[model samples]
Target chain A: MKGNEAIAEAAINAGCLYYFGYPITPQTEISEYMAKRMPKVGGLCLQAESEIAAVNMLLGASASGTRAMTSSSSPGISLKSEGISYLVGSDLPAVVVNVQRGGPGLGGIQPSQADYYQATKAYGHGDMHLIVLAPSTVQEMATLTGEAFDLADIYRTPVIILADGAIGQMMEPVDFSERKPRELPEKTWATCGHRGARKHNIVNSLLMEPEELERSIRDRFERYRKIEENEVMCEKYMTDDADIVVVAFGIAARIAKTAAQIARSRGVKAGVLRPITLWPFPNKEISALADTAKAFLSVELSMGQMVTDVKLACECRRPVDFFGRTGGVIPAPADVAEKLCAMSRELSI
Target chain B: MVGSSKRIIIVAGHFGTGKTNVSVSLALASASRGSVIIDLDTVNPYFRAADSVPELRAAGVRTIIPEYSNTNVDIPTLPPEIASVFFSDETAIFDVGGDDGAAALGVYERDISRVGYEMLYVINMYRLLIADPEDAVAVMREIEGYSRLRFTGIVNNSNLGAETTRETVAASVSYAECVSKLTGLPVVFTSVIGDARAPEGVENVFVMDDHTKKLF
Candidate 1:
């Protein structure tokens, strides 16, 4: 199954109905697929005029207490920055998909992992963070689509499934999760209108009062802290005896896995640290590796988005080195392995 | 409008994707049970699928489109929030607007998951570069690329405008198969001009496709 199709199917199966979007390359299949499939299943699939409108629609659906989502490429998501901020401000539950392409502008259509900064460091206006999930395979696309909805509803914060165009359009065998009937948590905060057994509900992001807004921001940050405590996800490969830890995410991490594997074969003592959840950053796990792992080698599609976070987490216990391919150029496994070996030798010397 | 027991249907598509014709016919098909169409397209400027307003209403198919909507201005105001009402109330036929991809997404994408949304993309192989399997996949990718919302199914609405024929309907089936193969999306239904009335099991499209298929 193509990754985009898997995401669409997962959204529907996870009980997603309202879909709003604009057309851009590498991420259009999800909307195109929904436009046709929603009607039969009794769902709402609309193509909006801009990324702004689409994000607003997702906001509306979430406000009304429905499971909703939108998808876009780098530039488009940048257009949706305000909406993402608003969703975070309001603390609404929804899903967003980014089939990343090369950018800084309307860059080329080839695959690139450039949106790491925008996704992880609160891409929108003001202080906020969205739950960002980085998926590697078509199977993960399907798997994460469902997980995003669950996390969004549970935390009342937007969840993002960040993938590049290649992952989205690429065809691969994937297992579609059975569409289980969703039992949404009680919504005292939802606006389904006042009714029997359901009380009046208000869902808004306007915290105009200075103290009130500060309190709201504080509360939201606290929730993020709790999420980091409970939901930080990462994968480690052959780190037990390794002297250097390679940290990466999304497609970059996948390549790192191969590179680390190759370097290990040649006895360079390289291992991979892949963060499935880009946001929580898995600080504690990396700290544990600080003693054994002589240095941290952070690789990203962008020049230095994740590296800064890695350095912050590792706290200078060991020196951190960086190697990246920007504007969507993906470094091959051999290149990564070679870099890993070189960096390992440099740190040792 | 029917109840929780009644089947709920959504007839949605991008602008100029013939959603009006599709929704009306589907409502007519199930007229025996009470049905209604809720118009949710707030993006287009002049042409909307809204004019069929009275027909669906007159046929006992309730239409819930916002009054004064036109294809000319940017009226982002949607009819007062009635989604929860719709959920608690009756069986409905949701008539969504055509392709202002971004504009059409207003106020509806976030809550559908909790309230429940089975989203489908309206595909007109006639839309530029949308007919080819790879192109169709590309178009879907483009939408996903911009909005960050993935599509779940394909609506094969291939017609040569008003020149639509039975053969064209078959061609649409083939186009749908191509999409299913390339993108792993299924063609849930197909639309053709009203007069050509396709065979049983072939979901009929409400729009008049013969002339526009060539023009568009």
Candidate 2:
């Protein structure tokens, strides 16, 4: 399955009955797939006039106690950011997929991880953070999409499936049968009307009093603290007693993994630590590796956005390096392997 | 290998049906006789034949792609150089986009008809929506309608990537046969990845190297 279509199917399987999106390259297949499959499953797939409207529609659906989602590429994602902040402020549960393309603004339609800062630090405005899940393969694209919905409902916040254009366009064998049912909580806070048996449920993000808004924001941060403790997901490959640890995520990790294998074959002690959850940032794992690993390399598709987070996680215990190919250019395995070999020689490890 | 008699070959199918792989393989196989592969996939911004230009050039196959391909610009404009393939003696193979992407082919309908071309509808039984024979035929007609061209044959390029085995290829034979029967088109070939042999009853086996897998 193509990564974009896999996400749409997995979203549908996760009981997402409403899809509102606008078309953008690299990720348009998600909308096209939903348009074809949604009606057959008694779901609604609407093509909104713009990304802003689509995201607002998602907010409305989520507020009404429905599993809903919207997807876009980098530029379109920029257009949807305001509505995303609204979704978060209202404390609504929804899934937003950004099959990331290169961009500061309408940058390109090729695979890129440049949106790392946008997704994790400043998706919209104000003090906020989105639970970002990055999938390195098409299979993870499916599994993570289904998991995104559950996380949204459990945490009562918006979840972002942050994928690059490479995975969105690639084809691979995916097994959907392995997904086990998740125990999800009910939407008691939903404003789906009361039949005189209960008080009216209101959903709003606007709190007039300064203290009231501060309390609400702090309360949400408390939930975020719990998430940070329990939901940090990372995959370590051959990290035991390694001198150089390559920290990456999404498609960059896949390329880095192969490069690490090549380095290992050539007698360099290199391994990869892929953060499946980008928001939590896998700090504990990297911090622990800092004890034994002499140095770290952060590889990305952008100009070292995540490298800052990597440095912070390691606490300067080890020297950290950055390697990247920005503006829609993908580095070949040989190129990354060359970087790893050079780093090893410089450190004499 | 594609017969030398066919001067122009166009590969079209629904999305993710391995159309670009089939086109690349066919062009590489025919490269010894002076071949050119045109990347006419304007709809998809990623994983197009343009991505394989380095390997294709290494194999001595000339490639003509959209001007802004692999760049930040997402314009779908076709290059003027594409029209030259019609007058050239080199065997021209077109890797067209999937489904409505075939609409880009309509621009050269007259030139293609005048030069005479063989359009192959690539099919993968493992792909969703078009998994059934009837659904596959529907997509085939849709492509034909959009491109203003008709398919001369069917290329059974079915396989589950990475996990595909001899058994997996063998399982798709009956499905491909059903699609061939529905469309009344001959099964031109069955593409098998790497060193796999043709499934028991399948003929005209095309051994394809998985070029797209190296992209990641």
Candidate 3:
């Protein structure tokens, strides 16, 4: 299954019923794939008029305590901001996908990972926390999509699947399993139409009072703190004797894996630090590795967004070098290997 | 895949591939008049059908996308409006960015599943990694990691040039067959551009035009 199509099927298996979305580049297959299958499996699939409508539709469905999701790339996710804010403010469980691309705007069609900050900080307004999952391969797509929904329901917060075009466009072996649907805690506030047993519930982000909003913010952060404790994810490869280390996530991490292999072949004791979860970044893991590794290198699709975090993880124990390919250009494994080797030699590690 | 209440639809694949094009074709094909196309290709600057939002609007097909269609734009976290549209007569298409789509949209399934909906996974074997079943599975897992949604079906959108002959269709048919064997999700349809006839063995044929809304 393709990544997007796989997500649709995974959602269905995960017990999703209704799907709403608007089409855009890089992510059209998600809707296209759903259009064909949802009806057959007794599910509802609709293409909303706009991203706003799709996201708002998610709000409606989630407000009623249904598992719903919307997906898009960098720019499309931008349009979904207000809706996401409402989801966050209202504490609704939903999923958003960002198959990142290059540049600030309409940069290029090729895959680039420049949306790190957007997914983590600038997605929507106000102080809201989201669970972001970064996958390095198609297998992770299936497992993480399923996990994201489970976490969303358990935590009552939005979960994000952070991937790049290469991962979505790329293919690998995957198997779909019927996951045990999460037993969501009753949302006493969901707007299920105020019928017989249901009370009229409102889901919105319009907290006018500073104190009230502040309290909500504090609560949200408290939830975030628990999430950080419970859900920080990463993949560490051969760092025990590593003199030079590479920190990357998603597709970049995959490339780093290959780079580590090649770097070792060239006699450089290089390793990789792959973060599966972009949010609640696995700083603890990196900081622990800093104790053993000589230095760290950050590779990304951008100049240095996640690198800042990697540096923070090192905490000046060792210098953190940076390397990347921007403007929709993918970083080759060989390039990463070469860069790591050169960096190791330069640092005389 | 557990007992989830919401069914989700995810659109993901490589760039320069036809996930977007096929998404539009699939939405238009399965949709019965009043369907909407939600464009989420905020990653790519050009080549998004949202450029002509008025066209889909005039055609009675509504659209929802990111705040802007620029490259440097931020990817927003929005709601999946399934409840209102699910029971309504309108059909919807969510056009997500290729790889970017998998990450962001993967989280909302728990919410939508509670409402009752099925999800679809679309594939274009012509794209990288997805050309093989193993690669396809890998991509699937990555998407699963985020959306928390289970995929129920597959849509084959494979073609070479504008003149996608039977060969292109046949190759994809074989690919979809293998994927079906691996993932247990049937390929429901094969999409074509213009009046390109449906490939002989395909279940459904989705036709799209140049002016039709494209995601990537």
Give each model's clash number. 91, 0, 172
Categorize the docking of model 2. medium
Off by over 4 Å in 3: A178-183, B1-216
Strongest candidate by lDDT = 2
- What local lDDT score does residue B96 receive in model 1, on the 0 to 100 scale? 63
RMSD of each: 18.6, 1.8, 16.2
In model 2, the number of clashes is: 0
* CA deviation > 4 Å runs, candidate 2: B4-6, B54-60
Which whole-number lDDT from 0 to 100 does residue B17 have in model 1? 54
Error of 2 at A136 (Å): 0.7
- lDDT, candidates in the order shown: 0.72, 0.91, 0.73
* lDDT per residue as tens, model 2, B61-174: 999988888677857989899989998998999999999999999899999999999999999999997999999999999999999999999998888888888888888889
Query: What is the per-residue lDDT of model 2 for residues A218-288, given as tens digits with 9 covering 90 to 100?
Result: 99999999989988999999899688999999999999989998988888889999999999789999999
DockQ of each: 0.02, 0.74, 0.05
Worst 10 contiguous positions by lDDT, candidate 3 chain A: A171-180
lDDT tens readout by residue for model 3, A26-107:
6666787677678977888899888889889988888888778888777778889888888899888988777766657666
- State the displacement of the C-alpha of residue A258, model 3, in Å, after optimal TM-score superposition: 0.7
- Residue A130 error, candidate 2, Å: 1.6
Worst 10 residues of 1 chain A by lDDT: A173-182
